[model samples]
Target: MADENAEETYDNFEKQAADQAANLVEQLLAALPEPETRNKPDGGLNPVEAARRQPAPQPGFDGTIASFAVNHDVLVPGLYLSRQDGDIATYDLRLVKPNQGGYFSMAAGHSLEHLLATWLRSSAYGRQVVYVGPMGCRTGFYILLRGMKQAAAVSLIREALQAAAAYNGAVPGTASTAECGHVAEHDPAGARQLAETAAALLKDWTAADLVYPA
Candidate 1:
């Protein structure tokens, strides 16, 4: 009887081992690749090689005063400050969007413009609010300076970014009749994100010589 009991125990162990092996095989088959396969290696082209062959997009115009012709019929070269009554010493921040066939809407760019301008003017660096508006080509904005020193805009940009990061104030001109285009209420979070990106870009900008007509 002891020998028969030992034989039964061995049989049980062998059955369990066989069951486990079958389960493992089933799992392996489930994880195996499908029979259908593509003939092309790497789906046709190598991603790294394709990327290396791709041409990069061209850069936008730098809007420098020197790029324009200064013929007698052309306007004199000077910085035009935004929203100023009569200031010839600064560059004007012109709104170049919202026109027919423009890329960005006037409403969207206007809100960001208002937030940036208001923040710059009210913050500790309010004095550096030279120009703040969109570009005509709907690509990006332009900032003209009373002086060529990049340091002039740096402080204000820093203050503005910190404020935006901790933004609590309403976007100016959104509710009042003085509204430029749109309000920051539409997307406060998105506005802050955009401000952070702009701040990062501004950090890399270096000041160059401010050349004016003599």
Candidate 2:
């Protein structure tokens, strides 16, 4: 009974810490100055114009990315926060490790993109789903949502990936599709195999999966 009490105390302490972290972020964001609404008259900023005007966060890095801060050698699959603007949050839904020869094959990634994007945009949570697409590095996808919680983002991606894992329909963009241009390159079987592997990894996510390793 003492051990059970200890475990309950530990759980409550953990929840308090998580709540404190969330409150800190809320305070920090509230302290920032208002964004420059360069192109609007009603004090509203167009997201596209704001994105175009903001200075690159890491100009000297490759592609002006802050990714240099990450040690790709130890990178693992998980939903890492990429950027947040107001309520929109973009997450790196990484499924493969980089610089370790675990990158996705072209056929598999393409099919996975089609399947996951379709599922997310049409799912019950579609109202919060903004965009889903493959990354240039061929490692995984970028999923954008309309909220800022890491736990909720991870849950949504896991559900989407699970759907993709069990998908057996005619892969969109395949030759069988009436509007497909590169139909011969599609691989539904390869896509399902990779999604199953990715879904397994996501099932056992840790805090390390929510942030980039430095």
Candidate 3:
């Protein structure tokens, strides 16, 4: 009887989670701004064309750091460019709160990583994708984009959080005996906790002193 009750509860949770995910996607789509349309003058160059014509000189401070420091820290988290290199950009996504213990069970982080990578690669904004992987410190994940002001990737972040909220469900690519190799397997409980924290952060994130390249 106890087992049966537990199974029933899990099923109900799955249903509720699916409904919530759909609602969140709707809200995000509604909040997105309409894209602007510009008429190109016959002789005037488009931004891309202008860029092609300019000499490949050193980038400004913000652009320089954003382009080269994929493996290095740019003092801030969310987004940054490396001052030393102008081609690398980074997207820092924290998986655990700072005050909380930094240790994430390997299973938990790895599982969450898989889910996030899958979602981001397939998201509408995937074209901007560069790299998606866990941070070396195990406290968070890093997503590198190909260009500056790559705010479009934030939508993928939102979708990842929604997917994380459905942690109880089976994670794709998680059950491979040969693939996982027992290197700290994925933990759904930990993934759910991290996901919730990330979701709250995203909702509250604003253009205050918190972001980079002010």
RMSD of every candidate to native, in Å, equals 20.3, 20.1, 25.1
Candidate number of the best lDDT: 2
lDDT of 3: 0.64
Two-way TM-score contest, 1 vs 3, winner: 3
Candidate 1 C-alpha lDDT tens digits along 3-54: 9999999999999999999999999999997653378554545679767767
Query: For model 3, what is the alpha-carbon lDDT of residue 8?
Result: 100
Predicted candidate 2 versus true structure: per-residue lDDT over 44-128, tens digit per residue? 6567866777777764635645555567788887678877779998888787888778688888888898888888878777888
Which regions in candidate 2 have their CA more than 4 angstroms from the true location?
1-63, 173-178, 206-208
Which candidate ranks first by TM-score, i.e. highest? 2
The clash tally of candidate 3 reads 15
Estimate every model's Cα lDDT from 0 to 1: 0.53, 0.79, 0.64
TM-score of 1: 0.42
TM-score, one value per model = 0.42, 0.64, 0.53
Residue 16 displacement in candidate 3 (angstroms):
89
